[model samples]
Target: MKKFVSLACVFTMAVSVLAGCGSAKTETKAETTGETVAESTAAAGGKLIMATEAGFAPYEYTEDGQTVIGVDVDIANEIAKAMGKELEIQNMTFDGALLAVQEGAVDFAAAGISVIPERQENMDFSIEYATSKQVIVVKKGADVITSPEDIKEGTAVGVQMGTTADFYCGDLGCDVKQYNKYAEAALELMNGKIACIVMDSLPAEQLVAANEELEILDAELFTDKYAIAVKKGNTELLDQINEVLQTLVDEGKVDEYTINHTTK
Candidate 1:
């Protein structure tokens, strides 16, 4: 009986030791996981995912069928480099770009986005990088439909959906046909599907110059300032982008890019 009791006690001691060992293993794993989470959060700093509508020429667009190149892309890259972070460009529609930043799907957006009070209510904006006026594009040598009033009552104006041009057309009571992309609208204008295409003057000029079949009216439409946009309340990121933008402007880098890319 004494020998049996001693053996049972030995067995109990072994089980307790194994259980304690298992607990220590679990605690170590938990500590490791906690530390990993903390490190991941810290390393995410300034590593930005930037979204843009890649169809907007001179601002953001694809080149050589593979490379995404534009003023916005260049500026964003410079900003990321200055911030000591990585930049990932997500090609998306203008509305999608805005939504991505708002939902934390992207860190920010730079799509030749115009800054307006309505948009400011939902998203933050960096310092304006470019200024543009709205313009109408039509077939070259066609009677210049220079002004909104010149558009015939039944004429249709093509515009990118969710853009300021769309809103401007609606406000002017002009008939509008919305396209998913700027290139689509430009194509429709080329095909005479729409009487005119309303867009930012700089891009419209670039497109018209390239196509040779289209021309822009001399009259100006609404003027607006374009800026990088971020999610509302993202003051840290907003301030950083603004600082970078101002530096570019002050150092004449912005002018250099404009001169290099502009069609003389």
Candidate 2:
């Protein structure tokens, strides 16, 4: 697993021809300056709902095509456990997951979501839990794209819509096809429909591992931070989510769960 890029890299953050996305469907203003406006709430012995696009693993991906599970799922479960609630996962598109969280349609979202300024306007994020390099994946023996610079307008690229990879790839000014799931983009890659795919590194590892014809580029497109997205003013839930996440981070469990999922 040398430099497999881990949650920092492991998920190239995606892979697989087998795709499963269930249907879907906020706000507490989160402080950006490392501060939390704590609030009081009653005991949580109910359902703690979370939205996610179950296509990015070891962060999130389905094994049975119906049951969504991964590092993000584990974290969400921990949040539920902390609140003394049951975890309910809603699997959907990456964009849909974020939107659901923003509209308060769900309690939160854990889609390996990157904390960009634009997103911050609509949703408050828990403290950054993981950092990832947006990576590029290409077919085996595709010598033309030896480096990021080689990817120009003529280079047709595929990406999961609304991901940091999608933004980074768009900046490259390449011809890009936006898919709801990286799984679909991977299908396109395997079919030789695109020159490459862009995504988080770790899931990219999973993708490449599953599809031998795919290979990750040594270069990175950009780096991003992953966090849980909640409504703008949901301080109670955001604080709880952050507390659980902080515990996981401090205990070194986040990286451990990430490694375990990737290795599995």
Candidate 3:
């Protein structure tokens, strides 16, 4: 009877020990998970995913095959380097880029985004990296339509959708045809589907210089300051980007980049 009791006691102690070991294992797992999470958050500091419409030239565009390049990409890479972070570029449309940043799907956007009062409601903009004058592009030797008002009624003015030029077309009450890409808008103008295209001065000039079929109108339409954008209330990220941009400007890095990339 005493042996039976001793054996029962041993069994009970063994079960107790097993339970304690199980509890210890569970706690260790929880602690490990917590540590992993903390480490991940810390490592993610300043790491940015940037979105851009890869179709806008002199800003962001594809060069060879899948290689995206432009002023915005260069600036973004520089900012990331300054912040000790990695920059991941997501190629998207202009509207998609804005929506991604607003939705927190991206850390920021640098698709030659213009700093406009209307956009300020949804996103924070960094300091202006570049300024571009707006110009009208028409066929070479065509009737000189200097201003928006000079465009005859029913004349189709092509513009990239969701761009400053698109808004300008609406504001000017022109017969506007919006395209997804600036190249497409320029092509439509060349094909006579649209009478002309309204675009930033540099891009318009580049296109006109490349295509003998196009020319810039003598009149200036407007000017816009291009900025990188982040979600509204993302002041932390904005300040970091702005700080890096100011440093670059002070060091003349921006001027060097422009000189190297700008069409001569």
Candidate 4:
């Protein structure tokens, strides 16, 4: 299951963004060998595929249009290396990445995924390796949603589908527009299509810096811990990942990766 077959499933199901962006990659081990990615001549062991959406900055985002890179990539790569396997990344929509891991179409997902009770039912998660808060991004001086208390029934808001932001706004009775990419949602906000965007604080910072007209509203929405998602019942791989994550935390490499990817 962890052989060459792993690549075929992803290219067919969740690679719509590859023509312009990229994808994370993996394989699953059978009873004895426990191989979840294909063996490559390039690696003495094999490959571990990771699924991610390259739209969230500092956590996961592509600097060059062709290759995806960020804190998640760095952490996933280190996890792969520690297990003696090479890492391959696939970039797709956030929702697609979530489904891919649950389906075991890829080995795991490392897209700054939040560990929540709702998602825990479908997939297993590694230890919490990162943290982020939800924030509102609105046009500067637009008093539309200055505080979470300001959100009203049917207030138009934007969020990436299947993210915590989506859940937050929906629960609060916001009329939500769910986009596959935060960039898409941001465009709508600029065009006055949506009142604001609900996104992670790190990515909101990146978005605000890139667009002077947008500012993250002054209010705390939600704080979420980020973790890697593995196929449910895949304890072998989950155990391997948790070990690496613990080491990264002990060495402060997680923070180092975040700083390196974050724009000054």
TM-score of each: 0.79, 0.82, 0.80, 0.83
Candidate 2 Cα outliers beyond 4 Å, as residue runs = 1-45
Ranking according to TM-score, highest score first: 4, 2, 3, 1
lDDT of each residue in 109-227, candidate 4, tens digit only:
98879998999999999999888888889987777778887776799999999998888889889898999988888889988999999889989999888888899887878798899
Candidate 3 per-residue C-alpha lDDT over 1-264 given as tens digits, one digit per residue, 9 for 90 to 100: 999999999999999999999998787666557444334333556466899988777777776848778878888997777656778899977899999999999989998789887888899999987888888899876674656677645567898888988887777677989887777887777777877898888777667767888888788877888888999998877988998888887888777776666654
Off by over 4 Å in 3: 1-42, 152-154
Find the number of clashing residue pairs for candidate 2: 34
Best lDDT among the predictions, by candidate number? 4
TM-score of model 2 vs. true structure: 0.82
Superior candidate under TM-score, 1 versus 3? 3
Better of 1 and 2 by lDDT: 2
Minimal lDDT window, size 10, model 4: 23-32
Q: Per-residue alpha-carbon lDDT of model 2 for 1-264, expressed as tens digits? A: 565556545454343212221111001223223332222121322688899999898998989999999999989888877776778999989899988988999999999999888899999989999998888889888675778887777679998899877777677688889999777888898788888888889999998898888899899977888999999999967888888899999999999999989888
What is the Cα-based lDDT of residue 14 in candidate 2? Answer: 47
lDDT of each: 0.80, 0.83, 0.80, 0.85
In candidate 1, the residue pairs with backbone N, CA or C atoms under 3 Å apart (3 or more residues apart, or in different chains) clash, namely: none
Q: The CA-based lDDT of model 4 is what?
A: 0.85
What's the distance in Å from true for residue 134, model 1?
A: 1.4
